[model samples]
Target: MDDKAILHQYLRTRRDSLLAKLEGLSEYDVRRPLTPTGTNLLGLVKHVASVEFGYFGEVFGRPREFALPWFADDAEPDADMWAAPGETREQIMELHRLSAAHSDATIDELSLDAPGVVPWWPEERRRVTLHQILVHMCVETAHHLGHADILRELLDGRAGQGSGDPNLSQRTPEGWAVHRARIEAAAVEAEAAASAADTGS
Candidate 1:
């Protein structure tokens, strides 16, 4: 594959992983915020869809057939970062997948050097090429995938980098607890030493 094709493939791989994180999870569980910042599996997917739609569709002046309610003028800020009360898991998942398809079309139809404007980006970097937007979107998708990975694992103990073979250590719960205590103890020791050095004690 060419350079653009390779980038698209990598982005799709991460997209699939993002969706996979929600698999076997209930609507409540998938949408439940697991972090202090309200990070959740479903919310991360929603955010990715919005990113794809904006980066690929709006940037290229290619209108999508569907409207994104999350981007409406009156929509609450960070609305894309969550699924609403009435929002179903299927709906969010479908939107993310559809957005991916839309982005893929943009990637396939345009040349890597095709010029476009990023309205939301800084003035100095508003004008961008297809290659640039593709990379940006890929980076956005991958970053969110990391968040999704952590949320999924915390929600269901399903820890892995992605689909296929797992990346989790094959350790029992007892072993993991001991490992965690050791790390905590080491951190405490290091902090105490640093404090003493600062005090010249």
Candidate 2:
């Protein structure tokens, strides 16, 4: 595939990876905030969906067909990043699917070099192209993908880069414990060395 196709393929892969983190999880599990910042699996999906809607839809002058009121002008900050008390799994997931479709349409209709402006970006950097936006979204989604990995693992013992393959060592529990201990010891040594150097200086 060409560069644009390649980018879309990668973006889709990351998006799916992020979504897969929610598979087999209960509504409460996916929505529960494992982190102190209240980031959750479903919330990360919601956040990325809105990211695509804005970056691909509004940036390209192709206005969104539907309104997302959570992040509206007067809405609470980062409101789109988390589901409200009454929000359901189906609601968030459906929105994600629709937003992805809209973003996909923008990617399909525009050339990689097609230029547009971001109203929310700094004035000096407002002008951007489909290529840049695609790349930016890819990175942004990847960020959430990583978050989902840890959050999912925290929810259960399942840990891997994706649903298909975890890419982690197949070591037994004892082996993993030893490996973790070794790493901790090394970290402690490194910290001590740094502290000694600071005292000497």
Number of the top candidate by TM-score?
1
Deviation from truth (RMSD, Å), model 1: 1.8
- Error (Å) of candidate 2 at residue 101 is 0.9
lDDT at residue 137 of model 1 (Cα atoms): 80
For this target, which candidate reaches the highest lDDT against the unseen true structure?
2
**Residue 176 C-alpha lDDT in model 1:** 80
Measured with C-alpha atoms, the lDDT of residue 147 in candidate 1 is 84
TM-score of each: 0.92, 0.91
Model 2 weakest 10-residue run by lDDT: 157-166
Candidate 1 residue lDDT tens string, 23-132: 88887898888888888888898889878888899899997877788788999888999999988888888898789889888999999999999998899989999999
Which residue pairs in candidate 2 collide? 160-166
